[model samples]
Target: MTECLDAIYQRRSVRKFTSDPVDRQIVEKLIQDAQMAPSAGNLQARDFIVVTNTAVKKKLKEAALDQKFLVQAPVIIVFCANTPRSSRIYSGRGELYSIQDASISAMVMTLAAHDMGLATCWVGAFNDADISEILMIPHNIRPVCMLALGYPADTPDTPDRIDASKLIHWQSW
Candidate 1:
């Protein structure tokens, strides 16, 4: 398989991490890859906050349903969406679209990190209000998700996936 496809297949959510830190330049490049993801109407409403502080990571871990791995990871990226930027044109649909934009960007970042031999877990269980208060997120920006990134302390086997034939439909379901 080609390198990109190989990376896609190999990508997995890693939960345990060592204390080693990732290079700042690599993290920035991953963020840049995320920015390249397509956005609705090209509004590009996604914003990211890279968190490395111990206290903040601890608070974030609490916000994220006490997921201990969140604190263990060397970096946590909080992905937020600027609702007004898309809502101006798409109205009610914009709110949802902006969320989609942020999610797409997060996925791109995850894939890029995996390609670089780093590990990540997409975390979505956080209390939005709590995270907003802890991170000081702006009222206009909604926190969509968080990604915990670092080098893995353990490698996990890929979980079983449903057969493609069971999921695919021809022209109609």
Candidate 2:
């Protein structure tokens, strides 16, 4: 399999992370790679907040349904969408498109992290208002998701997935 495909297949949502710190340069490169992901109308409405401070991460852990992994991870990337930016072009659909853009970017970051021998867990179950309050996210920017990134502390068995035959539909549904 191709290197990219190998990385994609091997990628998993790592929940437990070690205390080892991730390199700043590696993190920057990962974000830069994520920027290359396609965006709606090329607006690139996604914004990211990298939190490494222990205090901030602790607050985030609390805000994220008391997920201890958030605090254990060395870095937490908060993905947000700038609705107004996409709204300039798509009107009513702009906000939705911005959300899609952010999600795509976050996925790219996850894959890139995996390829770099790092692990990450995409977290969406959080109180948006609480995260915004802790991170001071602007009102116009919506918090879409967060990613906990760091070295793996344990290897988790792959979860079962639905068979492809059951999931795939022909040309029409």
Candidate 3:
């Protein structure tokens, strides 16, 4: 239980990455770990697109509102929600659940990467249509978030968090 909580506290959004290359195998391992996250109705309605090509990264950088640091990372993992995959089962609620599934998986992956001595930054600010066009994603798949993955070049200081009592609601809001 402590090990689980440790990742939550220790993980930081690392933007500075070393020039070292992240092996495909390691990235694959991270995805595998992320897949362990529970999905609604066990639909597992999500997909991870691993991007290593610099040309593509440049396009993604632009799509991400010119976040230059994204190109510095050796790998970028695009977290997508396969809406149709979920919608087939749950109809109207499936789309929402698919997004949740993808988000949960991404959260799990950030911690898994942290545990494996790697750093990641969750990049969510991006043009959805641009990303989909760049990635050549199908109609059913929606790009929800991106993960910048690489070895750390600089360690960031811990960020401040809101007080639990202030943020959390007990029985009602």
Candidate 4:
């Protein structure tokens, strides 16, 4: 399989991480690569908050349904969407597209980290108000997801996939 395909197949949502700290430089590079993702008309409405501070991580952990793994991981990246920027392009449909854009960016960042010998977990279950307060996200931006990153304590095998036959169709649904 091609390297990119291999990475996609191998990437898993790692919930356990070692105490080792991920390099700041590498994290920056991954974030940069994530921005290369296609956005709605290249508006690049997605914004990221990189949390490396312990206190902030702790607060985020509380906001994130008491997910201690978030605090244990060396890095936590919060992906947010700038609705106003996206709204300018697509009008009524901008909100949906902007959400899609942000989610794709977060997924890419997680896969990139896996390819770089790191582990990450994408988190979406949380209170928006608490998250915004904890992360200081602006009202105009909507939080899409948060990623917890570090070296893996354990890597689980790939989860089962649905039968392709059940998902694929010829021309119409």
Candidate 5:
């Protein structure tokens, strides 16, 4: 439990990454770990698109508002939400649930990568339509976020946090 907490605390949003390539096996492991994250009604309405090709990475960089890290990192995994899968059981709320499922999965994947001595940075600021077109994603699945993954070239200092007491609400705010 301590180790898990340690990993959680130490994990940072690494922007500068070494050029070292991440192995396919390790990426697969990270995905597997992400799948362990809980989903709404166990729908698991999420899929990951791994990008290693330089050309695709460059295009992704463009789609992500020209974040150079997208191309610098050895791997970029685009987490997506499958609305159809969630809506099949959840009806009107399924699309929202699918987005939640993908978000949680991305969080878990970042933590898992930290545990494996790898680094990850979540890229949320992107044009959804551009991402979909660049990745050739279908209509049913929407790209939630992209994770830039690799060995860290820079370890940023942890910024100060707000007091937990102030943020935590009791029975009511």
Candidate 6:
């Protein structure tokens, strides 16, 4: 299998991580990869906040339902959707697609981190109001997702997948 495909298959939501620190350059590269994710009509309305400080991570941990992994990871990426930025591009359509675009970007970031030998766990289980307040994000910016990244301390075996035949059909059902 191609390395890219291999990476895709091997990528897992790693929860435990080593104490190793990921350099800023690697984090930047992952964000660059995320920016390449496809968006509706090419209207990239996503904004990302990279948090590397321990104190900030601690606050985010609380905001993230006290997930210790949030602070344990070397870096945490906060993905937000800017309604104004998206709305200006596609008007009504942009507003509808902004959250979707942000989600796609977050997925890309996680995959890129995995490919770079770093592990990541996508954190959507949190209180939005607390997150917004802790992150100091304006109300105009909506938090969509957060990613915790670090060197993996463990990688679980790939989870089972549903049968493709059962999921796909040649034509309309």
Q: Each prediction's TM-score against the native?
A: 0.95, 0.96, 0.97, 0.94, 0.97, 0.92
In candidate 6, list every pair of residues with a backbone clash: none
Per-residue CA lDDT of model 3 for 1-173, tens digit only, reads 59889988889999999999999899999999999999999999999999999999999999999999899999999999999999999999999999999999999999999999999999999999999999999988999999999999888999877888788888988
Instruction: Please identify model 2 stretches exceeding 4 Å from their true place.
Output: none
RMSD of each: 1.1, 1.0, 1.0, 1.2, 1.0, 1.5
For candidate 3, the TM-score is 0.97
CA lDDT of every candidate = 0.94, 0.93, 0.95, 0.89, 0.95, 0.89
| TM-score, cand. 5 vs. native | 0.97
TM-score of candidate 1 relative to the true fold: 0.95
Best by TM-score: 3
Candidate 2 per-residue lDDT over residues 1-173, each given as its tens digit: 99999988899999999889999998899999999999998999899999999999999999989999998999999999989999999988999999999999999999999988899999999999999999999998999999999998877888899999998889988
Please write out the lDDT profile of model 6 over residues 118-160, one tens digit for every residue.
9999999999999999899999889999999999999788889
lDDT of 1 by residue, 6-33 (tens): 8889999999998999888988999999
lDDT of 4: 0.89
TM-score of candidate 6 on Cα atoms, chains taken together: 0.92
Model 2 RMSD in angstroms:
1.0
Model 4 scores a TM of 0.94
Q: How far is candidate 4 from the true structure (C-alpha RMSD, Å)?
A: 1.2
> Model 4 over residues 25-107: C-alpha lDDT tens digits?
99899989899888989888888899989999999999889998998999999999888889998986788878878888998
